[model samples]
Target: DAARQARYSFLWESAERMSCNRLATGHHRDDQAETVLMRLLCGSTLLGLGGIRPVDDSGRLIRPLLELSRKELEAFARCNHIPYAEDSSNLSEKYLRNRLRHKLIPEIERKYDPAFTRNLILLGEEAAFFRQCLEDRFRQLRDSLVEWAEGDSPRINCPAAAELPLVLRRYLLRRIVFDYTAGGVILSGRVLDAVDRLLVRGTSGRRLDLPGGLVACREFDFLSIGEKKSAPTGAQPEQIEIKGPGKTTIILGGLRWELSFEVRPYEAGTNNVFFQKEGAEGVWEERFDRDKLKFPLYAGAWRAGERIQPFGLEGTKKLKKLFLEKRIPCSMRMRIPVLRDSRGEVLWVCGVARSALGALSPESTSVLLVRALCLPVRGFTGVTIIDT
Candidate 1:
C-alpha cells in the first residue's frame, strides 16, 4: 500500500512538472478483480467496490488496459515481440495481493467457479456505473446543499440539510470532505457517523472533531465545517496602515480586499461605490464626513471589548454583538478587517458596522468616499461598500 501511494505521488508530481495533461498506468483487469475482492473482504461502499477507475475523478490519471486481462497482454507481448519485465515482488506471499494471486484466488478458482476472477471484474464494472450515477446526482445538488466559505471551508444550513434523506445527507457530507482533503483520506466512515449525530440532535455550540483535522461545529443556524487553524507562536497580527486618497490592496487569510479613499463632493442620491449589491453591501462604501476624521487610518483585527456607535443607532454596540446580529459565523469574524482612526477610535468594522463618528450629513460637503470591493473571494460575497 505504501509503495503504491509513493508511486502514485511520484507520477502526479512528475506529470505536473512536465506539464502533461494526462497520466496513464498499467493496471489491468486482474488488478481490478484483486482490488474488488480486497475491498469486499475489508468492507467498502459501492464506490470503493468499483476498484481502480480507468480515469480518476480529476480525469487526469488513466488506466488504458484496465479492462484487458493479464493473460491477453502477455500473449500479445509474446506474439508481437514486445518485452516487458514483471515485478519480482509479485511472487512474495508477504504482500496481501501476492497471497491472493498465488494461493487464495487459485484455490477458489480450482474448487469453485472457473470464472471467479472474471465475475469479480464484472461486479466492479457494475459498481463503477453505479458510482458514476451517484456523482452526477451529487454535482446537481452540491451548490444548494453546501456553502463553501473562507476559500475552502464548507458549511451547510443545518435545518435545511437535516431535512434531506439520510443517504443524501451522507453523500453530500462525504463529497464536501473529499473535495476539501483532495481525496487524501479514503473510505472513511468515521466523519459520516459523527456529523450525522451533530446534525440530528447536537445543540448549538456542540461540535465533533472529524478526520483530517476537519471540524464540524453546530451553530444556531449553520453547521460550520473547517480545518483546525493553529495561531503561530509569538507572531502578532499585522496591522496594515491605510494612508491614501488612492487605492490600497491587501491580502488577508487567503482573500483580497481593495480599499479606496477619495475626497470628493458628496452628490445627493448618487453613490459611485459598488459592491455588487445594495442593503448590507452599502456598508462597504460609506461617505464619511471627511472633515471629522483624523488622517492616516489603521486597519487591523478586531480587539476584544471593542465597541462602535453604529450609524443610526443611539448608543454603542459591542463588535461581538454586531457580528451575532449580522449572523456572521464566528469563524469569519476575526478575519474581517476592523478599520480605526488615528485617535484609536473605531471608524468602521469593515463589512459589519460603521461608526457614527464620521457619518455623512446633509450639510457635509467634500465627503470622504471609502469604497471596498471584496472581489467575490472563495464564493464569499461580502460587502463592497462606498461609504466607510
Candidate 2:
C-alpha cells in the first residue's frame, strides 16, 4: 500500500508535471540520529550505524535536512516569520521520536551545554564525513582486492583481503552484504562473525544464509556473496582458449575482467585462503621460480555439461550436480567462471575449486599463478570476473 501510494504520488508530482525531479522532505538530524539510536538498540547491522541514506537509489526522495537540526529549523522559521502548521499531536507520547524530541532533548540541552543541539548536529556532520572517508577507503580496497561476479554479489580473495587493515576489511565486508531493512530481521553478530570466519579460514562448501535471502559461500580461496541463486543463467560453462602466459579480458553485465599469469614454485596442496574482509591480515605474496610454471593457462565462464573432481569428493562429478548438491540454483550456475590450461584441463572454477592438476606441489618445476581482476563499469551493477 505504501509503495502504491508512493508510486501514485511520484506520477502525480513527476518532473513532467511539476518541473521537479522529486518531492523533497525535511527530516532533521535529531530524527535521523534518533533512528540510528533506535536501530542500534534494536540490533541493526553494521551498515545501519551510519543512519539513513542521504540519497536513495531512485535519485529521488532525497533527505535535504540530513544536516539540519530541529532547533535550527524552528529558529529559521521564526526568524523568517515562515508560517507552518504545527501538529499538536506531536506532544503525544505514543511515538518514541516525538517523545525524545519533546521530553528528552530539551532536558538534555538544559542539563548539558546550551549548545547541545548545535553540537550534536555538528557531530553528526563530522560523523558523516568520517563515514565517507571509511567508505572511500573501502572502495579503494574493493577496487584492488574484491571482484563482483555477474550478479549483484561480491567475491573476495580471502588471503589477499585478510592482509588489509582491520577497519577497511570490516567496512568492505559489511558494505558488500549490506541490506536496507530498517525494520526487518537482521543477521546477528554471531552469524556475521561465522561468515567472516568461514571466509577467512573455513574449508570450501560452507555456506551461511543471511536475512533478505542473501547467501554467503566459501569456495576455493574466495568468498562469494549474493542472493540464493538457482541455476547458471548465461552460456553454459565452456572451455575457453587462453593464449597462455599473458593477460586476457572477458565481459559480463557490462563489466570487464582481466586474467594474468606468472610462473613460480608450487605448494603441496591448495594455498586455498579465506581472508576476512576486515583488518590487514590476509595480504601476502607467494612465489614460484619462473621456470617452474606451465605456459598458456586458460580462463573463462564455466560451460554447461562440464565436470570436476571437486576437492575431497570421490570420482568425477558433473558441475551441475555439484552445484545442485551445494544448493546453487540455475540462475547462479550461469555466472560461475572456469579456468583451464592448453589441454582443456580445468584449473580454477571461480568461487568453487582449483583442479588438483593445477594444485601447486613442492616438486613442481614452475608454478602457474593466475590473477583475476574485474574491469570498472558505469554504475552499481552486480559481480563480474576476469582472469589473465
Candidate 3:
C-alpha cells in the first residue's frame, strides 16, 4: 500500500512538475480484471470491485489503455517496430498481482472457465456503472451534509445522514474514509461495522482511531474526521510564541487546525478588576489579569502530569483529570493547546480549562487576546479567544 501511494504520488508530482494536466497509464483490459480480482480477494465494497478507473476522481489520472488488452498492445508495438521492455518486477511472484497474473488466474482459466477474465471485466463494468449513478447522489449528500474541517478533514451531520438509505449511509461514510486515505487503506468489513456502531452510540467527543492514521470523532450530532494528531516520535513538539500584539498563525506538525493569536485593547466591558467571557455556547474566550502574565507566552501540546488551577476551582487539578471530567477523549488530550507564560507557568489549556492565576479584573484595560478559528465540516466554526 505504501509503495503504491508513493508511486502514484511520484507520478502525480512529476506530472505537475512537467506542467501536465493529464497523467496517463497503460492499464489494459486484463489489468482491470486483475484489479477486480485483487480487491475481491482483499474484501471490498461495490465501488472497489469496480476495478481501475478510466479517469480517477482527481481527473488527473487517466488509463487510456483500459479498453485494450495487454496482448493487443504488445501486438501493436511489434507491428510498429516499437521496442519496449517489461519490468522485471512483473514476473516476480512475490507480489500478489504477479501471482494472480502468472499462476492463480491461469489455473482458474484451465479448470473453471476459459472466459473467466472476460466475465470479471463485465462485472467490473456493471459495478462501475452503478457506482457512477451512486456517485452523483453521494456528491449531493456530501455538499449538503458533510462539512470540511481544517486540513480537509470531513465532518458529517449524523441526523441528516440518518435520513439516507442504509446502503447509501454506509457508502457515503466509506467513501469519505477511502478518499481521505487516497486508497492507502481500505476499511475491512469489521472496521466499517465499528464505524457504524460508533455513529449510533458513541458519545460526543468520542473518537475511534482508524486505519491509515486517520481518526473518526463524534461530536454531538456530527461525525468529525481528521488526521490522527501525532508529532514525530522524538521530535521536539512545535511551540508557537505569541509576542504580544498583531495576528499570527502557526501550523503544528501533524495538526490540521491553524492556531491564531492576537492581542488588543478591551474596548468595551464592565469596569471590573478581572473579566472573562465564556458560556454554554458561542466562541470560547479566556481573559487574564494583564500584570499576572509575562510576555512572549508559549503554546504547545499538553504535557503529561501538567496541573492547572482551574478557574473557580479550589486547588490545582491535573489536566488529565480535567479532560476526563469534560469527556474529552484520551486520543485527543495530547493535542490540546497548553499555554504557558514566559516563566513556564501554564496559564490556560485551550478548549478545556483556564487557570485562576491570570484571572482577569477590569474590562476597560487592554488585554492580550489570542483567537483560534477552525472550520468544522458540518457548517460550524470553532473559535477561541484569549485575552490579557
Candidate 4:
C-alpha cells in the first residue's frame, strides 16, 4: 500500500497495485554492474560476489528485467509502443548508482573501448561460475566426514578427514567447528593448524579451545567437537594406584589426589559407601577371603583390552563399554584407572563401576577400602587437568 501511495504521489496513480507475485522495477545489467562494484568495496566476505539472487524471501519484490540490457529494454518499449513517464529526479547526481552510471562508468568506457560494458558482464559471469564451483567443493567436503550428536560437539574423524585435499580440508574443518558453535564464529588459521598438527602426528589426547566457546578435542584418534562451560572445566585422564597398607599421591591432567589404604571389618555395603565419596569415587579396594584367595593378588593401572564383570551383573563387560555407558565424555575415558587382581581380573573401573568378582559379600569379615578424589596436588607443578 505504501508503494502504491509513493507511485501515486508521483502521478503513477494509474499503476497497478503491487501484488505478491508481481513487482515492477527497471533494474538492468548496468544496475548489476554497479552492485557488484559497490559490494566488492564494502562487503566483509567473498560470498557477496554472487550479486543479486534469483529468489527473494520477501515475495513482494521482483526483478522482471534482471537479464535485460538498457538498450534491449529501450528497444522493447519502442516495439510495444508503451508510454511510461521517467522520474525527473533520476537525472540528478543524488544517488551513488546514478552518479556511477552517468559520469564515472561512461568516462571509463570513453577512455578505454566502448565495449567495457560487455567485458564487465563476461567477467561477472566467470566470477559467479567460480563461486558455484567453490560451493560445490565445500559441500562435498562437508558430506565426507562431518557428524553431529545431540547437545554435544560435532565429531569429525580426524584421521579420515586429514586425508582430504588441504583446501577442502581446511574449509570443512572450519565449517564443522562453525556449525558446532551455531555459526557464531570461525577458528583462527593458527588454531586449525594446531588441530591438524595433532591429527597428522597421530596425537590422540591433544586439544585446543577455539573461539566462540568451542573446544576441539582429539578422540578415537579423531577430532570431537564440544562447548566450553563456566565451571567444573573439562578434566583430563589420570592413572593413580593405592597399594595394600600403602598411601600414595600423584597428579595427572591438572587434578590433584592422594590414595591411602585403611583396614577394617569386611561388611556388605560398608566400604561401598566410602567408595562413593569424592576421594573414593575413582578408588577401588577389595577384601578377599585369605584362605580362598591368593596372596599375590595385584592392584594397579589398567592394561589394554581389560574387561570386568560389574557389581550385581553376572557377565563381564568391557572396561571401555562401561565408560561409554556411564556417559563419561571422550577425553576422560582413557586416563581413568582400572583396578585388577593378580589373575587378570578387574575389580573396579575407577569413578565408574565395581566388578562383581571382588564385590562385597554379606558374610565378608575383612575388607580393603579404596578412595579416589579430586584434591589440590601440592608441590607438583606442570600438571594441567581441565574437567569438562
Candidate 5:
C-alpha cells in the first residue's frame, strides 16, 4: 500500500511538473466490480459501495476505460497489435483484490451466475446514484441545522437536528465530522451510532473521544465537534490584580480570560453579582456582593489544598472535591480560573462558586457585578459558565 501510494504521488507530481491537467489510468469494469465486491465484503456503507468513479471531479485523474471490460480491452489490444506487459502482481493471491479478480470472480461466473459481474456493475451505479442523493439531502439539512462557530469546531443545534430522520441524522453528523477533520478520518458505523445516541439522549457536558484526535462534546443546547487537545498551559500561577470598575483580559492556564467589573443597577433578568439582599436569580451567571469584596482582586489558577465556601453549602469544601462532585474533567480543573482576595483567600472560583465573604446583603447600597468570560483556543469550544 505504501508503494502504491508513493507511485500515485509520483504520477501526480509528474503531471503537475509537466503542466498536465489530468493523469489517466487503465481502470475498467472488472476493476469496478472488484472494488464493489471488496467494499461489500468489508461491510461498507452505500457511499463505499459506490465503487470507482470514471473521473475524479478534482480534475487530477481520469479512468476512461471504466465502462469497458478487461476482456474487451485485451481483445482490442491484441487486434490492434498494441503490445502491453502483464503485471506479475495481478496473478498473486496474497492480496484480497488479486484473489477476487483471479479466483473468486471467475468461480462465481462459472458455477453460479454468469450475470454476476453485470449485476455488480449495476449495483455500483445504483449505489453511486443513491449516495449522491443522500449527499444532496445532507447538504440541504446541514445548511439549516449546523452552525459553524468561529473556532475549528462546528455546533449542531440538537433540537432541530434530532428532529431529522434517523438516516439523515447519521449522514449529517458524518458530514460534520468529516468537514471538521478535513476528511482525514472516516468514522466507523459503531462510532456513528454512538454519536447518534449522544445527539439524541446525551446530557450537557457529555463528551465522546473520536478518532484522529477529535472529540464530540454536548453543551446545553448544541453538540460541538472538534479536535481534542490538552487544555492550554501557562507559567507559574500569577495573581492578576483588579482594582475597580474596568475590563481586563488575562492569559492564564492557556486561555484568554476577559474579566469586567461594573456597578450596575441590579436587573431581575440579568446575571448581576448583587451586593443587595436579593441575591442572584439567574442560573447562567454568578452574582457577588461588591461591598463584601476585598481589593485588589486577584485571579489565579486553582492550587493544592484550596477550599471554597460555596454559596448555600454548609461549610468550606476542597476545590478538588467540588470538581469531582461536578464531574469536571481533571484536565480542565486548573484551566478554571479562581478569583481571590489580597490575602489569598478564595473568592469566586470562576464558573464554580463565590466564597461566603462576598455574599450579597440587603444593607449594601451598590452592587458590584464581576463577569468572567473564558475563551477557548483554536481546536476547543463550548466554554463553560458556572453559576452558583
Candidate 6:
C-alpha cells in the first residue's frame, strides 16, 4: 500500500511540477480483470469493483490501454520489435495479486470456465456503470446537504449527513476526505466505517486522525476536515530590549512580532491583564504589565523540559503537560513563541499562557502591547492563534 501510494504521489507531483495536466498510465484489460477479481475476493464495494477507470473523476489521469488486453499489447510490441523488460515481482506468490493472477485465476479458468477473464471484465464494466449512477445521486444529495464553511479547511454539516442513507453517508465522508487531502490520501474501508459511526452516534468534540496530517473533528452540528496543526520550523531564540516607550519589530518562526511599549494607567475593568484585539482576523495583539516584567526579555521557540508558573496556578507546571491539557499538537509546541525574563523564567507562551509575573494588578501603571502576524504559508491564508 505504501509503495503504491508513493508511486502515485510521485506521479502527481511530477505532473504538477512539469505543468502537465494529463497523466497517462498503461493499465490494460487484463489488469482490470485481475483487479475486479481481487477486490471481489476482498469483499469490496461496488465502486471498488469498478476496477481501473479509463479516466479519473478529476479527468487528468487517463488509461489509454484500459480496453486492450495484456496479450494484445505484448503481441503488438513483438510485431513492432519494441524493447521491454519483465518484472520478476509479478511471479512472486508473496503478493496477493500475483497469487491471484498466477494460481487462483488460472485454476478458476481451467476448472470452472475458460471465459472467466472475459466475465470479470464484463463485471467491471457493469460495476462502473452502476458506480457512475450512484455517484450522480450522491452528488445531488451532497449539493442539498453539505454546507461548506469559508476557511482553508472544509467543513460539512454532520446533522444533514446523518439524514442520508448509510451508504451515501459513507460515500460523502470519503469524498470529503479525498477532496480535503487533494487526493494525497484515501480513507480505508475500516476508517470510513469508523467515521460513519461517529457521524451517526458520536457526540460533539470527538475527533479522528486521518492519514496525511488531516483530522476530522465533530463540532456541535458539523464535521471539519482539514490539515492538522504543525509548528513552524527553523525557529531560533531572540531578544527584544524595551528601553522606554518605543516600538520594535522582531521576526521569529516565520512570524513578525511588533512590540509597542507604552505607559498607560491600569484599568479596573477586567482582572485579565492581557488585552488583545484582532487587528484583522488572525492577526494577534495583546497588552501586558511592562513595569512588572523583568528587563531583557528573551523570545524564542519552546524548549523541552521547560516549566511555567501559569497565572492562577499554584506552582510551575511542565510546559509539555500544559500543552497536553490545552490539546496542542506536538508538532506545534516548539513552534509557539515563548517569552522569558533575563532570569530564564517564562513570562508568556504566545496565544497560550501568561506568567504570574506578567499579570496586571491595580498598582500596575505601565502596559506593553505586543502585536503578532505570521507570514502566510503555502496553503494557509493566515495564522490562527492557538488559544488555551
Residues 329-380, model 3: lDDT tens digits = 5445554567788877778776666777766565436566655433343333
Model 2 alpha-carbon drift over 4 Å, by segment: 1-16, 29-72, 75-81, 150-153, 178-190, 229-388
Error of 1 at 27 (Å): 6.1
Clashing pairs in 1: 284-385, 284-386, 285-385, 285-386, 285-387, 286-386, 286-387, 286-388, 287-387
| lDDT (C-alpha) at residue 123 in model 4 | 59
Candidate 6, after superposition: displacement of residue 167 in Å? 8.8
Residue-wise lDDT of candidate 2 within 1-388, one digit each (tens)?
A: 4854986577656755867777567777877767665555567544455666677768777778878777899999999999888878667898776777777668878897677655545545565677789888876777677775553456778898778766566666777676323324345667667777877787667788877887778776778876675654565444356665666676543545565666544556645332121131111122333453355555666666777765545677776776656555443455455666556666556654545554444655666566655444554333322211
> All candidates' lDDT scores?
0.77, 0.61, 0.73, 0.60, 0.78, 0.74
Cα distance off (Å), candidate 4, residue 32: 2.6
* Residues forming the 10-long window of minimal summed lDDT in candidate 3: 272-281
Which scores higher on lDDT, 1 or 5?
5
* Candidate 1: segments with Cα more than 4 A from true spot: 2-31, 53-92, 101-119, 146-164, 180-187, 195-228, 232-283, 287-298, 312-315, 341-343, 356-370, 373-388
Put down candidate 5 lDDT per residue, 254-283, tens digits, no spaces.
667677777755444443343221122211
lDDT of 6 by residue, 265-383 (tens): 66766456443445443545556786776666666777778899988779999888887777665434545667777688887787787778777778777666655555444344444
Candidate 4 to truth, TM: 0.46
Q: How many clashes (backbone N, Cα, C below 3 Å) per candidate?
A: 9, 53, 12, 19, 5, 0
TM-scores of all predicted structures: 0.66, 0.52, 0.55, 0.46, 0.73, 0.54
Assess candidate 6 and give its TM-score to the true structure. 0.54
Cα lDDT tens digits for candidate 4, 1-388 = 4854786355433334432344556678877777676656564234445565444546645677768888788888999998777778668898666787788779989997697766666656666676677668877766566655435446786777777776556667776776666668886667767767665664555677777677777665457777764554345233443335566665443344555555567655654423333332233334443223333444444444678877766788876676656655555554455555657577665566776665556766766665545453332221122221
lDDT of 5 at 117: 94
Q: Quick one: best TM-score, which candidate?
A: 5
